[model samples]
Target chain A: MHRKLIESFGIRVRQCREKRGWSQERLAEYSGLDRSYVGEIERGRVIASIVTVQKLAQALNIDLADLLTNCGPPSGPGRSN
Target chain B: MHRKLIESFGIRVRQCREKRGWSQERLAEYSGLDRSYVGEIERGRVIASIVTVQKLAQALNIDLADLLTNCGPPSGPGRSN
Candidate 1:
C-alpha cells in the first residue's frame, strides 16, 4: 500500500530486467504485456495480479518464490524447491 | 499450474500457520477465511489469491517478501530488500 512497497516491487522487477538485459519494452514483449503498463508496474503505480506476476517470473526465467523472497525475510520456516 | 506448485503454496501457508501456533479454525478466525478452505490450502487442494497470501503474511507477523523467498529460486539476479 505504501509507495515504498510498490517501489520495492518495482526494484525486484528491475533486478530481473537488468539480469536479462531487457528494457521495459522488451520485458513487455517477452511477457506479453503492454510496454507502458510494465513501466507503470516498475514505477509502483499498479498492483499486479498473481497471474501477471507469474508470467513475469516465467518470462524472466525466474521462480516466483525467489522473486518474493528477494524482497524480504520469511516470517517462519523456509521451503525447499 | 503444476500440482507441485499448488502444494508449494499450501506449504508456505502451513508454515505460517505453524509459526502463529494457529489451527485451521484459529487461522480462519484471524485471517477471515473459512477453516475448511485453510485446510484445503495446506493440503494443496487450492491456489490462493495474493490477497489471501497478504493476510496470511500479516497474521504470521511475517513479510510477504520473506514468504515468497522461502518458496523458490530467482530465475535471474536477485534483488535486495
Candidate 2:
C-alpha cells in the first residue's frame, strides 16, 4: 500500500511536470531540488518528505490536493472510515 | 513557506486524531509510529516523510486530500498558478 501511494505520487508529479513541458532539470531548478533527486522522486525511488512534496506542488503550480489525487487508500469495503 | 506547510500538516493531524477521540498513543499505535514522534509531528517540530503522511491518513481513516486541506500556498495575486 505504501509502495502504491509513493508510485501514485511520483506519477502525479511526472504528469504535472510533463503537462507544463518542463524537464526534470527544469523542475529541479524551479523547486530548488537536485535534478537527481527529482528524477528519483519521479521514479518512486525515495519517500519524499512533506516539505519536498510541497516544493514540488509549488513548482508545478498545482494544488496539493490536485497532486495527491488517488494517492490515498481506496474507499473499499472493510475500511474503518 | 516550508515551515508554514509543516505546521499546517501537523495541525491537520492533531485535529483529525482529536476528532476521532484518539490519544497520541492510540494514533501512534494505529499508524505504527512512535508516540513521541507523533507528538513531535503534531507540534510541528518535524517534517514527516511522505510514507509517514500516508500512514497517518490511513490510520485516521481520512483522505489524503482532506488531511492536506489548506496546506498549499494560498492563491494570492503573486502566485503563478
Candidate 3:
C-alpha cells in the first residue's frame, strides 16, 4: 500500500469526524466499527475495505465521494486511483 | 456485507469496464490483479479493499469517487455508512 496515500486518507477521515464533533468512539458506534479499529484507520494503520469506507461515509452523513474528495495525491499513471 | 450494495458496485464496475471496451482480463492486467479476482469483484462475490479499489480506478483512468458515485441505495439510517 502507498503509505502517503493512506496517511492522507486517515487525515481526511479524522478531519471529517472532528468537524461533526464526534470522537473515534462515536464514529465507530455510528459506523458499526470497533472504536480501536476506527482509531487504527485514523492513524493509517489499516487498509479499509470499500464497505468500511462506505460505512464511515454514511456515519458521517456525507457522500462517499465527499469523504474521499481530498484524499491522497491526484490520479497519476502507474498508481492506484 | 450488504448484498444489494455490493451488487450495485459490481454493476458499476462492469459498466465502466465495458465503456472502455476492456474485458475483465484486460482490467486485471492493468490493475495488477488476478483475472479471477477481477471476475469475482464484478460478480459481487467478494468485498474489495480500498487499496484494490484504488488500483482498479487507476487502471480504468477514473477517480474512485466516480466509480462509487452511483453505487447502492441512498444513505439511510442504522446501516453501515
Candidate 4:
C-alpha cells in the first residue's frame, strides 16, 4: 500500500472513532469490519478497500471526502473554486 | 471500484483541476498520471490507486484529507478535535 496515504488514513480512523467516543471494538461493530482490521487501519498497517472505506464512512456519517483531505491542513489553503 | 466514491472523486478531480486552471493534459503531466487516466478520473470512469491519488493530491497542493471531506459539506460539519 502507499505508505503515506495509509498512515494518514490510520490517523484519521483513530481520530474520528475516538471523537465519537467509540472503542475499537465498538467501531469495528459499527463499521461492520473486523476489530483487528480496524486496529490495522488505525495502525497504518493496511490500506482499506473501497467497500471498507465506504462502510467506515457510512458508520461515521461523514462524507468520504472528509476522510481524504483533513490530514493537517492544505498548504495552499486558497479556494481554487 | 466503489461506484459512489469513484464518481465522487471524479467530480472532485474535475472541479479541483478546473479551479487550478489546468487542462486535462496539463493535470495529467503535473500529477504524473496519464492524460486518459486523468480523464477517467475527471469523468468518474475508474478508481485511482493510492499512488495515483497521492500524485493528484500533490499536484494540487491540497491535503488528502480535503479531497475526502469536501463532498457537498458534512451533514453536521463540526470539528472533532
* Highest DockQ against the true fold, candidate: 2
Stretches of candidate 1 exceeding 4 Å from the true structure: A1-3, A69-81, B2-7, B18-21, B28-52, B63-66, B69-81
**Candidate that scores best on TM-score:** 2
User: Model 1: clashing residue pairs?
Assistant: A62-B75, A69-B69, A73-B66, A74-B66
In the range A1-81, model 1's lDDT, one tens digit per residue, is: 445555776788877687555688888887788999899888878866555677677667666756644633221232211
Model 2 agreement with the true structure over A25-59: per-residue lDDT tens digits: 88898889999999998899999998898887777
Pairs with backbone N, CA or C atoms under 3 Å apart (clashes), candidate 2: none
Clash-forming residue pairs, model 3: A54-B81, A55-B81
The CAPRI classification for model 2 reads as medium
Of 2 and 3, which scores higher on lDDT? Answer: 2
Candidate DockQ values, in order, are 0.19, 0.59, 0.45, 0.23
- Residue B29 accuracy (lDDT) in model 3: 88
What is candidate 1's lDDT per residue for B1-81, written digit by digit as tens?
646666876887787666555677877877678899889988988766556676666555566655554632221232211
Instruction: Score every model by TM-score.
Output: 0.58, 0.84, 0.82, 0.62
Better of 1 and 3 by lDDT: 3
Better of 1 and 4 by lDDT: 4
Model 3's DockQ score:
0.45
Query: In candidate 4, how many Å is residue B9 off?
Result: 1.9
Q: Report the poorest 10 consecutive residues by lDDT, candidate 1 chain A.
A: A72-81
